[model samples]
Target: MTQLITERSTDVIAAEINAIKFQTQSMMLQASSEIGKRLIEAKEQLQHGEWGKWLKDNVEYSQSTANNLMQIHTEYNSNPQAFGNLSYSKAIALLGIDAEERENFVQENNVEEMSTRELQKVIKEKQKLEKEIAKKEADALKEKKLLQQDIQDLKQQLEDAHQQSTDHEDSEKEINRLTQELAVAESKAKKLEESLKAKPIEAATVEVIPESVQKELDQLRSKKNESTDPAEIKFKMRFESLVNEFDLTLHALDGIGNSETKAKYTNAVHKLMDKMRATLEGGMS
Candidate 1:
């Protein structure tokens, strides 16, 4: 008798648990439909500010709770063919996703088999992944904008440098022509001095050349020797060294990943070259 009573008690306990499960499932079904219907009907009443009191007094539910129920019906009730047998919790977790995504998610994950906790976990993971991707896209767009600005600045700098280069070239050309003329004049003066020495002064009254011409020739020779200036030679050497350094730096920049930084350095190099050219021209002058 004692053994039979124990078996009966165990069966009763199991039956009680099953009954609770059936009642809970029934409550969820009604909440999905009935709660959704009541919320929809109360939309106008809500605008009139009556539904808040109604929800508190008559429905005995918070607005957030009702909102979840409405989302369930909106997402799943009308599309039960796609989202079959979803629990209230799983459907709530899927509220933010659209219909097509709901269908795919349900099919892909066998959402019906998932417990509420498992579904919520997957939803959180999905949201996190989406946020990460959005952040990456935003960062890439920002980086692209910075690069474009750098390129624009570089273009403007190049244009300015080109104009400066033209001016420097003109100055260099004119100075080079004058230096060549001074060299030729010096050579001619040396030949004249030698010729004057070779020709004997037959009479003291006979002038070898005009005093003014001789004085001018001597001044030209002195200026020609001074033109081999040490400062000018040093400037040329420094300019050549800087040019080679700039080339090497540009080559190194090609290996670097940061184009914006490289562009800034390149602009600096161009400015330095311009300054060097100006200094050299001033020295020559």
Candidate 2:
């Protein structure tokens, strides 16, 4: 008997091996899915307490194994074609990903070519990244809420300051009106005294300004002189606003989680303070 020898190129051999691997993986996936489906049916028919005993006696499968198989069936049974290149181990490992993201993750990562351990590592990393992103988003939302509250408080303070300014202006106007009225009254009194003096009457009753009125006029004049200057009021308002803004900046700095970023901002704030101090000292000089 004579046997024929076959010679194949490396490329042809590699292609053949890959084809075989693909067929083998496809069969494995189908077999596991079928087994899982039957196990699910069996569990449904069994009594509530007999599930473990049935698995042990009938199939020698532990509850954990049965659970994994049922879960695999539930996840893969709907669209097995999409994952036809996945081996049983690969499919099982892929279960770590959510159903919604599994297809896209598999396609993007070429999960069919990855080992089970590699797939698990990638899944863990992805989960960790997602958790970090969610935490950052939550922190950003909280910061936004705090900033909005701070803005609302600042607006209220501005409104109050404006109302006070308006009241001060009204008070100044009232004082000016009273001064004008007092001047008019004094002029009329002086004219009446002059007319009496011209008549030379012996029993002329002269109208005299009351002591209380004189004192009240003096008090009004003092108050007018002591009233806050408009420019001074403006300066005070601006200074208070600057102080509040600086306080808000400090508050914002407290929320910084990165030490390097916080330190940078702290240094900037110190420089700004030094500049302001220098400017103020120069003005005093």
Candidate 3:
């Protein structure tokens, strides 16, 4: 029976100790909140430039400590009941979180049950995660902007290509029309030649042609002389054909995406240009 009594007394003593511990913690939290509140009031009442001096002389506190207390008061004064049992160290550690989120964080993580170090660590990790997520979101937004710009550029290029294709079709149609006109002119010229050959020259008094007709004949003779100039016609035709071929080559080059192949083609064009330049220089000399 004595042994049983001793065991029960031991259990009662342990419960009392736990209760006292709880009460002591609560009192400390209340004291801290009160101190913070008084600090805030004192700071507001003090002169603008006298805060640091007042803190140092009157309260024997550093500027940092005073700032911390004022921040704590601002964050916790309104709802001290929610955090009445928190220790001073834990409250200070929890200050890392925003005031609105602090209560929820404490409830969710059971911060009251955790050590100050653990709470600080958890807050640090949360801050790091938030930073990482913010950075990623910013990067994603930047990439999205860049992608949109690229899309816009591609759209403009496509529109330009469509316009160029329309112009090419028009040029082809013009070339076809000119070719048809040339063929008809050639057929008429052949018939006229045959008629002239079949007609015999009759002796008659010289008849004066109209001034407009003489002028027309003179223009035709001049045009015939120019057309029969072999070197000039050959030079013009060769130059036009070469220019067309070079334009086609450039279009083909634009289609090549491979850097190495494009570089090779570019080098070949450079060499050809150098050779042409040298030939032209020799001819000029």
- Predicted structure 2: lDDT: 0.67
lDDT of 3 by residue, 1-285 (tens): 455543467889999997888788788877766788898888788789998998888889998887777776788889888887788888888888988898999899998788889988999988977776566445435534543553454355445545555556654443443333333334333433342344321111012123564465445323432343445444443543454345345545655789999889989988998999999999999
Q: Which structure is stronger by TM-score: 2 or 3?
A: 3
Best candidate per lDDT, number? 2
lDDT, residue 170, candidate 2: 66
lDDT of 2 by residue, 1-285 (tens): 899899889999999999999999999888888889999999889889999999999999999888888888899989989998998888888888999999999999989878889998999888877776566445435534543554454455445545555556766544444343334333433443343334322111111223564365445334433444555434433543453345345545655789999999989988998999999999999
Whole-structure CA lDDT of model 3: 0.63
Listed in order, each prediction's TM-score against the native is: 0.49, 0.53, 0.54
lDDT of 1 at 217: 40
Candidate-wise lDDT, in order: 0.59, 0.67, 0.63
Query: In candidate 3, which residue pairs clash?
Result: none
The Cα error of candidate 1 at residue 76, in Å, is 2.1
Per-residue accuracy of model 1 over 1-285 as CA lDDT, tens digit each = 455543557789999997777567656765676778768778655667776678899778888988777777666677565554565667778875666787888888888777889888888888776666566445435534543553454355445545555556654544553444433433333443343344322232123234564465445434432444545534443433443344334445444568798788768867986998899899999
Task: Indicate which candidate wins on TM-score.
Answer: 3
